[model samples]
Target: MSAYAYYPGCSLTGLGKPYDESVRAVFAHLGLGLEEIPDWNCCGATSYMSISGDKAVALAARNLALAEPMGLEIVAPCAACYLVLSKAQHTISGYPEIAARVHKGLQAAGLAYAGRAVIRHPLDVLVNTVGLDAIAAKVIRPLTGCRVAPYYGCQIVRPYSGFDDPLRPQTMDRLLEALGARVVEYPLKAHCCGGSLMGTMEDIGVRMSFLLLKEARARTANMVATACPLCQYNLEAYQGQMRRAYGEDVTIPIVYFTQLMGLAFGLAPKALGIQRNLVTADPLPVTV
Candidate 1:
């Protein structure tokens, strides 16, 4: 059994509670142990970086410092947390000045990180580390009747290649397939979900979300499986807004890949947090 330092970011504890629950449930089902990083703080998401690069790096590095002692790779379930942590590590390692400042910030917080810990997203851990064959072996209830659109949102694969092709990722799609789901061809899989733009610019955010949902519906997908909490929230929560704005009723359940995995693993629906979903009209087509 492989162990990892799990960093469930702010959103996961809040609006993305189901994602957090499903992540732990799926990992436990797969015999993967996750140690929660002690005293973890916010990753600063997309806001702090825009305000101050040095401070943002420091904030992200603080979490890395916390995980370094665990001596295991850190797996962040939230896409924004993964990106922020990855970007901070890359920037701090590449630039001496930034590293120095981040070190100082860590010192102020009574923490120290030597960049020994590697940051990874759950998708990368599942497909690359856990192996699809191992996952397929544990699928007790195959998702044979479900047609899923695997949505990758924007951050997980981008600016940090190697794990997958950023433009056309197939990790989630392949995993769903292994679970006996009919994976729909999602061309806009890597497109942005407007991120914070959904809050700052409602019109643009709703429009972008509508387009993605529209594409998924066009392909006859019953539900969209995502690896990012923000993407799940945006796509699921914004359907009514999109309909009011564009007169297109695109209502589909946006579920976390972990939730799907849990179902396939024969875990109870409540354990996977399926009931916490905002959009409950189109429930997951999985049964115990």
Candidate 2:
């Protein structure tokens, strides 16, 4: 099988390095090919888009333009990157007025935009393209006792519900079950994890993060399985702040979904970047 053009986004190189490591590890283990696209730029992130739509699309479209020549689909692991790339693709394909401006911007940089690049979230690829039974067959260390709250955050499914349900996503839930883990019925799975909201407004953002993190714990999940780097960071790194603001200690292990999959595949914790997690679930392999 051909490898997908991997776009690590900017966040994946920073606090989200574990996510990068685990995603690479798991995909490699599953025999999926991941070619990191050369000279890939930022997807303009959320903040940049808010400041300037034209410039933001121009910024994000460059990555798509680069990937087009590669003749492979772009697999964006970061939620913001996935959304922005998807939006950029849509803008260039559907909005002619903006597309002309974006094309002009790309030409100045010695690149071109054709709207042919396809952007995908890795989870969608693994669960939808790879198939669950195939993943189950590779599991050497099943997550039998792992009760995971599959957090989807507000991006991914929203604005583009092509992969799963917008309101009630079940991709991660089913994928976790396939790995021999029990899925907690997390109602706010699609809710915002405050993302950069915590950075600008401490109280409101922390409150949002605290409530969602608290809900997962309240529902009896021992850990959270997230796809977005920002969600993982906001939910995991701010536990202490959340405790202070919410007056409840709802701290629990927060991890990338790929990390748990790596665990089930019998990959070592270090290989999956499990040691990089702030909260420790330190779980034994579940037998289902």
Candidate 3:
């Protein structure tokens, strides 16, 4: 009915700024609106989940409670935030003890949680709510020869995400096809991108990302399109790490799906934050 309450999470605001821009740009091009939820706090990502489930849910609860006033669905672009927020909602709703504790925690900040906030991913909103045919009509330039590998990573549709089938997600594949790009059949679409494990376990993470890039390249995918910032970072930033692991080079530009949408809409590359990426997305030719 109205603009979504945008939640940037830590990654989107810090490391994933381009994603945030492109998501806004594509939404604007599609004639949709997104209003950032004011004074939003962290969803605690995966870090707090291991230490304390209650505190992490409380952190996520605060953001959900804040969105109550806006009365709009919360669109979280980062996959980790999406999962954590969804988990928080489930945890709060399923457990009366958790609900009571989180409610008390929110009350201390002049806030309350009635579980009114509806959390959604940008992909879910764009493809489901906005519709691909509607998006296709807005494309000023079609990605004629661009071969894209749709990587859903491990979080977006996992556990609680209801928008798409988690194991065999086709939302991105279908959306990219609408943009005129060949969607590479990626077997590792839902595979783990090593996520924070890349930081904590270095080589293991690099090798995992290396597999995704290798597969995309093997399938003749010129670039990898993903909805998660951490997936983009791990895949794009770590191609140089495990060169020995791959018999052949596995370097490919990993980009947000929204950037491709912007290109199809004739939006500027700079505006989509293409230059912000470590691996130059120079090969994705856009005919304006």
Models 1 onward score TM values of 0.97, 0.97, 0.97
Q: Which candidate is the best by lDDT?
A: 1
* Residue-level lDDT tens digits of model 1 in 62-142: 899989889999999899999999999899889999899889889887888888868899888898888999999999888
Per-residue alpha-carbon lDDT of candidate 3 for residues 1-288, written as tens digits (9 for 90 to 100):
358899998898878988999998888877778898898888898989889878998988889998888888899999999999999999888999989999999999899777877899999998898898899998878888889999998899898998888799899999999998998889899999899999999888988888888888899999999899899888887787867665668878888999999988889998898878888776677522
Stretches off by above 4 angstroms in model 3 are 244-247
**C-alpha RMSD of each candidate structure in angstroms:** 1.3, 1.9, 1.4
In model 2, the Cα lDDT at residue 159 comes to 87
Clashes of each: 0, 3, 0
How much lDDT does candidate 2 score? 0.88
> In model 2, which regions exceed 4 Å deviation?
284-288
- For residues 105-199, write the lDDT of model 2, one tens digit per residue: 99998998668888899999999989999999999888987889999997899886489998889999999999999999999999988889789
Evaluated at residue 183, the lDDT of candidate 2 is 94
